[model samples]
Target: MAYAPQEVVDVVRMAACLSLNLGTPDAQRVTSMVSAGQEANLRGIPVVLDPVGYGATPFRKHLCSQVLRNVRITVIKGNVGEISQLADAGGQVRGVDSMPGQIIPLAAAAAYARALGAVVAITGATDVVTDGRRAFAVDNGHVYLSQITGTGCTASTAIACFLGAEHLSPTLSPASAPAPCPAPATAAPSDPCSSLSPDPDTGTDPSAEPVPDQIVLQPHAIPPATPDTPSTAGPNPSPLGATCVTAPIPSAAASSKPAGDHEPPPYLTAVVAALAYYGACAEEGAE
Candidate 1:
């Protein structure tokens, strides 16, 4: 069904997620896809794109680029050939089918994910999902899946469903820990020398001659303790001993933020979950 640009925007605003497929796109559909994607992005709705038959023709490739450029895609699901081609990693693609033996490489997929800044799922015998930083492999589907058409497209739809549900769920609400309290200030111990205030009686004696700088020696002076003769002195013993005030070391948990809190739900997780669910369903149906 054909939709106007305004109509597409209206649909996207009400939708939880948007899915774009290049299965049968023309110049008009391409414009609609861009318009829908932009509207979805503005509404903060997740978008899943399937670049069907991407490398089959230059026109399809161009349309894919335009759609991707216009939208902040959340996830991309495609066959090995299509994904590899999108990543600029050459692969044999005959018509709409990925050439047999044309396996998607993990390195290429990771590079693509990083370049696109989106979770990428390349479907095959062993489905690979990655968000650049982490990759997951889902090996659960029956051989019958390959026999069926639209399995790749179905996977894209499944991803959109999962993204939509995630969007609606309140689990994703912001749950930030409270800011740490400022440590209490403690009084510093007074220096022993500070106790010897200037003699009050001699305070105004400007006529007093400036005394020569000299070290006063006590009559009962004790020799500096030699390092060889270890003194059984506790920390900072006597008024003359050097004093050190060290702050308490914080606990490990308080010092470092929890790894879970820092990382948002991984996009790769959603992709893997969707693929696994589909694969499980396919396996059950086959049996």
Candidate 2:
């Protein structure tokens, strides 16, 4: 469906997370994606980017770079070749598929994550997830997944869902909750000094008015999804089964900064969980 840029922004305002996929990008779609992503960032909604076939063409690379530069991405999920190419670490790609036998170092992935300020997930036989400082390897998928199309996109969607649930849930701590956007400032007609000239005795300048009270734009409360919610619950059982098992890797001591100086974002755990679940699903489907 074609969405105007304003419509895209409206949709993103109510969304808990936004996912931008570069599978079959066009100029209009790219424009909408960037607009929606900026809106998502303003609302503190998580944004997931799937740079599909990023290394295949100059246009794809440029589009991916555009999104990365314009949006503060929460998670970036792609195959090893795509991630490697994006990180400038090095890998071969034949169209959208990663060439077999290429070895992109895990450290490269970590460094890329640090540089981009987003969690990076590289899917392969042994999936790798990292935030530069900490990393994890998830071994839970089937080889058959490689034969399928759109699996990478689906994985990115899953990560967005998990992040949305965590960030938008009512139970989230107030300190960590996404801050509400402030409404556009308008001249307050009721301001006593708004139209008043500077008084001779009491120096009050109408031009130099005090800041008006800003109206916090509280988004409409979205009810938590339940089993009864049709949108959240599919009409039929999903062919891809759901399961998750993750093993955390020890943090690399590469940073000169002291440990615990900065805690990893909560979305890091969400990305790991999503990948583990997605890989397990693939395993079950292949079985």
Candidate 3:
């Protein structure tokens, strides 16, 4: 599905973060989301699962559970009551929103995360993100933001904006993910740039993954891909898509050059900053 038209996939990948006002997706539709999620993981896009009103009804809870179990969710955002329900707190919920006076509990948040095997983010006057044992409190938001509808979804979407929306590698895992982007993500420990984040002992958000040092280059190296036959490009970049790359050079030349002792070409200085610096120093800018 990700290999489909660029617009569709980009929207689909960012749908988790974007203010996608999708109605309660049915089981079959949610299953498609799961498929898209796994593809997003393989393609290295961030997936955010929102259990909008999980505990409010058996249907919501069951559907959210299925999505959590299957889809690759980078963060799960919900109000206190909603999150509590997912955690099985059985808090009283008036409609989908948490009832007024419902207190957010750290234990419930933690339990929900453990049960779903993913990071949990609960939104209230203050937002709490937890991977069961580890927790982070993110306070960078305007109170007015919540006054509007779809604001929570917007925040989730904001997280994805730093991805393909900005600039980055096509193969690396997402960085600065507010919490764990659980499941189906293809990012690995071998990724040199992978953030060692969500500190288990203390709550510290490894700041958002730094955009790959923009190195001017040609048609970027497509992500590692399996093809019916080896082709030059895999899935094309979607508008809102963010890329997770392996060891990336600051600039394109460094990436293309060999690290061994071989001397760089004279023209190599023309494009590569490292080689250019060396060449200028070696020859004092002589023609």
Candidate 4:
């Protein structure tokens, strides 16, 4: 969100996390977004990529691949199909809803978590969370909540806000309001190296013909004229890879960074928020 810093400060700043929810089947576009997000993360922010309607298109499947390969997310929150699609584990999807998967078993989910190196949060009749080695299920939340289009993305970000806070605690506790996360670590060398893979739906070569809905973000490009505005530039959001949008919790150290690139990571805050949300919901009890 570089077009106007203030705008980013207004929209993204208030935001606890950055959610990449692909509305289309553009496999390649998804790839670009994942890379862009990691760039934000390097800056200390946390990113949450929500893959909707996986198994809906060959392009969508490929997009999942590109996303999985690029970002180091704190949490991967989705229904069964979305999570299943992520690990190259096959499953059926109904529009954006999950039908089921061969990996529906708890062991399968744990295996997927190990392979992907992420915490898998599957929201089904019950919700399951695992970092490959550990798993927890959350039975809170209303079914009506799932009807909304961006609810999952929003939920993921809400969790980010908590993690990004100074104590990595949710602001919901008025008595325990926390300060922001530390500023980004821009002094670190440029991270041109990312795990985000190219279009497997298209071809192995970077210059290969792109399949329909297949696109990837380049390693060097400028992002966000502002958070409200969308970026059209392709690839390379920053030549140095120091501008990841996924932010960490804002700490006193954030103030030490130089001007123009000192944005604190919202990611850590979001996670704190997520934990807080669950706590609140648990207090209220299930409907």
Whole-structure CA lDDT of model 1: 0.62
Best prediction by TM-score: 2
Query: How close is every model to the real structure, measured as TM-score?
Result: 0.66, 0.68, 0.49, 0.52
Highest lDDT model number: 2
Model 1, total clashes: 0
Candidate 1 root-mean-square deviation in Å: 27.4
> What TM-score quantifies how close candidate 3 is to the native fold?
0.49
Q: Write the per-residue lDDT of candidate 2 for residues 136-209, one digit (tens) a residue.
A: 55555577877777788888888888788767666668698554322113334333222212221233322233
Error of 2 at 4 (Å): 3.5
Per-residue lDDT tens digits for candidate 3, residues 244-273, read 121222343533322331222111111122
**All-Cα superposition RMSD per candidate:** 27.4, 19.5, 20.7, 20.0
Please, what is the whole-model Cα lDDT of each candidate in the order they appear? Answer: 0.62, 0.64, 0.43, 0.46
Write down the worst ten-residue block by lDDT for model 1.
Answer: 212-221
Model 1: per-residue Cα lDDT over 165-249, one tens digit each: 6576543444542222121111111221111112222332211222111111111112122334333334422211211111232
Off by over 4 Å in 1: 1-3, 171-266
